[model samples]
Target: MEKDLAPKYLIHKDEKLYFAFAVIVSIIGYLFLIVSIVGFIVWLGFAILSMFLYGLMMAQIRVNGIRLSDKQFPEVFEKVRELCERMEIRVVPDIYVIESGGALNAFASRFFRKNMVVLYSDVFDLINSADDGELSFIIAHELAHIKRNHISKQLFILPAMWIPFLSEAYSRGCEYTCDRMAAYYTNNAEASMNGLTMLGIGKSLFKKVNRREYLLQSSQEKGFFPWLAEKISTHPPLPKRIDEIQMFVGDSSSSAFRRTSRAMWLVVGIVLVIFTFAGIGFLYSDEIEEAVNSIVLDANSITNDVSSDEDSTIMVQAVAEGDIAKVKEQLESGIDPDIQDADGWTPLMWAAQDNNVDLIQLFIEAGADLELQDYYEETALMKAASQDHVEAIALLIEAGADPNMASESYGWTPLMTAATSGNLEAARMLLEAGANPKSKDGDNFTAFLHAKKEGYKEIADLIKQYEDNVN
Candidate 1:
């Protein structure tokens, strides 16, 4: 940990803080697990199996991909060897240059003890053509990840790996550390910045981009969605990484990392997914088969589970759970389609939540009341229209559902609900189905006004068109 391969001045200041926090939480979690020996043994077994399967998958990937060797792609191979020598790494990772469907990216991977580097063909082309050591910076960046043992340490801190912002912050800090070392290795700061900029914009556009204005614009962009997206991401965003590279080159000790771009955990993810489904299928074979069979909407399976007593409970429950077969069976056994629960919500109302067209048709054919209101005084059409369920709205309207039916709370009619929610298709369906666009909600806002207030310009425009045609 004390050995410095890169200059001490370039390393990120907060990398140690975030790593230490995760380590502390991991230690606390492990100490509590010490009390439950059986549970610990089960977890240990599962971890071992996952590692074994994922290691095999990585080995297969290395064999299948085009490997860079002494005879082919020798320049890239030499860079790997050179970086390992400079970083004091004991092993030189095998580098593979593979075509990634025009993806301009690269990744560092390790399985068991063998490390591998994957370079997309386009990134290799871009880096190979550059003269200012951008290729060296990219190779050195991945090498720094190996030198720091970022991948291996995740096992010990497994408990804290999925804890919301904590692990993601640790990962972003690791990325900053990598960027600093890479910038230090290249020596030419602007070239290293260009290498990162190439990742954000494509290969053809990096030279023309004004870095200062780009950074300023990205910094000024603010909202809850952007903040939440970065908080949940594993790597710092490309612009943030570029800013950190600038700080590193200037020997500034401050941190400027935030947000994320592409993900890097893709190497082992495919193997884990394959083994997860395989393990689950093997463990629950019978239950899985039964569940699959129960959902077959054939006439034979749908009419099988008839009850002797005429009870509405099973039919209502089946409709709520989306078990179409069970619902049909209950209906065939003489249960009422308009059966209400304690809250006066019918089977049709429960089915409306998912906007199931088949279920709605069955209730309509059974002579269920289309205008029936729940405890909240909302019709099935009101529920469907607000969600922009166009197919459901069309079917309900064709079956004579009241398009103008209003719910109790805001007295929001189906058309007003669709407009307020910015559901353009649902609003159009309601309008075409003869819903009155001029009708007002409890707040005295018409559907047109509702669309305008909610910033739905297209919906407001459509409402205006309908009003103009009427005039």
Candidate 2:
């Protein structure tokens, strides 16, 4: 009993109106900033610049088709053509991968002969390797976007691009429309569900990650707070989207697909209606409007100020944990292993502590300063020695870290620290590198005495052997 899921609504039927609105909204936004002549000019200048940039991007879509011709997977183009035929679409957009996209994403651009589809590498890798059913269904969904002219409809709502509040609504509507088109072409309700799930929920290594559980989790996310957040997003919540397809295709009979009762929608509608009027009233209220403006300004300022520290921290921790893949991500993002954290600890320091000799060698080759020290005046070698990481000690010594250089805080050479900790292997390596065995610390304790106190018999024996050789 699957019903027609095709988007019956022609999103772009009124392109002229949409174009008019884009222009009108741009002008209105500019005018709104006209409290001062300087503000008006600034606003107008920015609007013009944005329009020009977007125009340039649109112009590039023509060449995008040529660029798509060089794709690593030629089969994608064939799939696009087949889907376009099935959907009775007059044009199939040239598809290309934006290798720069580090996340999963796909977007369609308007063009003269054909629109353009820019698939991120992440998404292409997923779809290209999927089973035939999953892969074909996904292609159909993208085609449905073109067939229903969803991209044009979104362009028609261009005013929302200027109006932040309405812009969010416009974006979400586009997603809903595309989902309907996807379900229409896939025909199987489950296939459309699978496509949406893939987009929202990335593939997991654990095969037991249940789709039913995922749909349930998505459903629970539609409470008041979550729905409010969705209002500001360009896409519907995954559960709501899944429900939309299931409802359209008469698949709601599944317990997992059944939505909250009609009464719930009624209550939500009343609440929304009330809030709409309330919002209109508040916009006209000087005090409320001022408060809203202040909040917006503060939020924007905060967002702009939060630096990208997570990239470095994650890289550092991954290096410590000996994770090659995570290290690669940071490197790909142009992270510097030599870059010191707040405590002046670099990836080399973490590698030393973890006794990761290979990673130590890697960081050294990547231009890590072998002499860099932490707040504790511990060089990577010192850290390796204190933890008795013999292999790491060997790598650092080979990397030419100065064995004679004493820590500024502890005033102990690498040899003194290694001897005191009873790391005989580290002590032997440092001594061979011409370390001054007699180097003393703040406590005036020599490497020999420290080794005795730390109960390092083997290190003590090595130190005595060095002493005898000196005599």
Candidate 3:
């Protein structure tokens, strides 16, 4: 039998173009930096800051997160080693998982010669809930970033970061390249899509989300705001990301083609406009400098006279305090119920975290978004479960909350939380409301496993019974 050739999903055209654009812009930035000794000093400061920050993060991950090794997280360690061999990565990067609270994200970084990958605990848990292939796609994605030496490349282009849209475009291109590499390494397009979908919605709900309809939603996001948002974003939107993966697999008939094509033209148009402005600025340097100085002065004058609104802060505080009257007043005054505080926590989240069932009801009645995640990607139900707030959990479910909804960061449904905390009543309530007992967390531990591990015999027995009944 003849040997089969591996499928080749090469570097995307946009990736190449954007990278070239970034290099050119970086060269120009370097030229500008060399024009003045102060500019060179500023560039040096930025480089030092970058190195220091990465080093600090590396230290934090080592100290606080679990390091993958032969004994600890052995399965993931094996995957990492296998991926490195397949990708031909010489120096296997150190991988660590830190407590992310509820944030579901991962990143690969380098401090001088030391390359490391930091996986958020919740994001790492995807390995258990989804197929290991999905986790492999994610790992390969990060490894692809390291293998491509993207961090070092960006370090050289540090000066280009000052360029408004150009740097963002280049960063987005790098992301697409890494995504392609991840998909190629895993050789599973659907797994890759599911991984990205998990990042967007979380683990439990991702399966229920229609991938085709989700991609179509991107087409409806037209006009300047959406276009400008994409142009200045560090990563392409999730739908576009899925499209890029599809393109790699030679599936070009979908609407992703149209959206991606539009995005490419938008990038080209923006780049042209940026270069034209740069040309004008160079041709009329003195006039541009004068206008910039005037604008800065005006901005300072306006800043000094503006007073900040404290109403949102007060509203959030009232919700946290469970002051029904104050909450009612705020709602009556037409304050947005969905407004997030500084930490991306809405008033409803505050109420849920506080386990105030009545306050939750009030917020719901006032049109609060039940599914809103805080900075940690924790829904209200997750928070309630974490605290064993039975009444709150019952109320949330009665109000149409999905019992199977999992946090994107932790991959734990309410049932898992109840099991971990040994809250038997809460676990029973969740089971009765249709929560999946077999649902796993980021670590792949199901509610049953959590119950067993925690010595909650009753809960474990209940879960076993539930599984048996389902079977």
Candidate 4:
């Protein structure tokens, strides 16, 4: 019954604001493009390159991925057809399954005139194990994107992407609309919320995840930074999204809900004004700086006696400055190799960050704890991999650092760090030294998935090859 309602009815107020702002930005961008030949050429070149790249990627997926039809996954294919009818989509979009190495994600993308939905293999497996309504909800969510022409709208609004909060606001609104449509298609609010839960925690643990307790945490996400993060993000936080769905399903609203909503919009309005002024200031910065400099020319200046104190420990300074001789001298003088600084950074950790192989070796020989973690629970190995310090990573690993050791915060391994940074040599070193390529972080993302997400194609392929060989 909800599907019968006009699609425009689902569009949020923020979505309308985003579109109006985006239209203004696009007009200005077009005017600039017409006036500046170089800008037009540059934009055209980038647009062509992007289209080509996207087309190639889509072609690869179509060629290599599993296509679902009536013959294969008949029930799922039938459900897709049914949802397409309900959503009033004339063309049934093609569906493909690609290997994600355990990442839980599905996306609907457009290439030229063709619209396609990609379901990560692991997520597909999750859907297969769940009730038909779960699969229906997922498929309908993606189909809703197509039905609403979101992808094409995004293309039209491409120039507005340079505008900070406006573009992301539009994207988040689109997500909310799609979620509503998905619930409408399924007519099962519980299944709809559970689908989002599976995305957050994955299939195995989703059932055990208390929905009320999870949604309750949204009340705690307040203040400027949290509001700014959501404003700049393409998707709303999962808890907020789930709550929005609950509200849509005629759930009774609370006073806390009203307060949070008002606070979020207030932040958005304030940030919008601030960024608009900031953009204006950037355009006239030279004139503004000259005027301010002239006005402050006669301002009183205060002077203070400053002292240059060489106060840090000899060993810490040596490691920080990459002084091999000082490090050797301090080691000979019985300086503790693992002495931490103000932020809990050990000498070896500093050396690792600096990619100082000599200092790393010196600390290792002087009995530095290879497994010593910093304040963030990041080991020297993680630091080396983060900076793509191949030789330093090798030295740390050879000195008995665990390649599979995960950071306490996000369970990010040294391999995950290397893969994310596209450090091929460091990834290879970690993989050869017994780093588990399939090892997942707190979000269940493997090193391969990280590489893929970052568009590090070579590193992703290397991880895939290593994983295949291991299995």
lDDT of 4 by residue, 6-40 (tens): 66566554555555555556667888999999999
Model 4 Cα shift for residue 303 (angstroms): 69
Per TM-score, what order, best first? 4, 3, 1, 2
* Candidate 1 vs 3: which has more lDDT: 3
Model 4 residue 70 CA deviation (Å) reads 1.6
Q: What tens digits encode model 3's per-residue C-alpha lDDT throughout 1-471?
A: 121334223455555555555555666778887898998997788878977886886777778788899999998999899999988885577798889888878899864345688888888887676467778888899999887667766765576666677678778877888888888776778888888998899867877898888887886788888988988799989988997787667665655435345235444444664454444444554353344345543653344222112445778879877789999998897777877665777787778778888899998888777787777777788778877788888888889888898888788687887888888888888899998877878898888998899999999999889987774
Clashes of each: 1, 0, 3, 0
Ten-residue segment with the worst summed lDDT in candidate 1?
300-309
lDDT scores for all predictions? Answer: 0.72, 0.64, 0.76, 0.77
Better of 1 and 2 by TM-score: 1
Q: Which one wins by lDDT: 1 or 2?
A: 1
Model 2 lDDT, residue 421, Cα: 73
Write candidate 1's Cα lDDT for 1-471 as tens digits: 122443545446445545555555566668877988986897789788988898886777787778888887777788778778877875677787777787778778876445677777777786446543666777778887876666756665687685667688778888888888776665566777888888889777888899877776777768877776866888877888888777655533544444343233223242344333434444554353244234431322233222211244566768878888888887786766777665666778777768888898888888888898877787888878878888888888899898877776777788887888899999999999888878777878899998899999999999988877764
TM-score for each candidate, following the candidate numbering: 0.51, 0.45, 0.54, 0.55
Estimate the Cα RMSD of every predicted model relative to the unseen true structure. Answer: 23.7, 18.6, 25.8, 26.3
Q: Report the C-alpha lDDT of model 2 over 1-471, residue by residue, as the tens digit.
A: 255333444232122222233334544554566667887787668868966887687676445523444254667676677677767874456676666455656677654324667666666666545444555566666666666455554443343475543455445555666666666665556766766676665644313456667777766654677756865676767767777677666766665544343223223332354334434443344343244345543643344232223444677778867997778677666776676655767789888989987788878877888887777777888888878887888888888888888888778788778876767778888888877777778899878888888898888888878877774
* Candidate 3 vs 4: which has more lDDT: 4
Which candidate comes out best when scored by lDDT?
4
Off by over 4 Å in 3: 1-9, 257-471
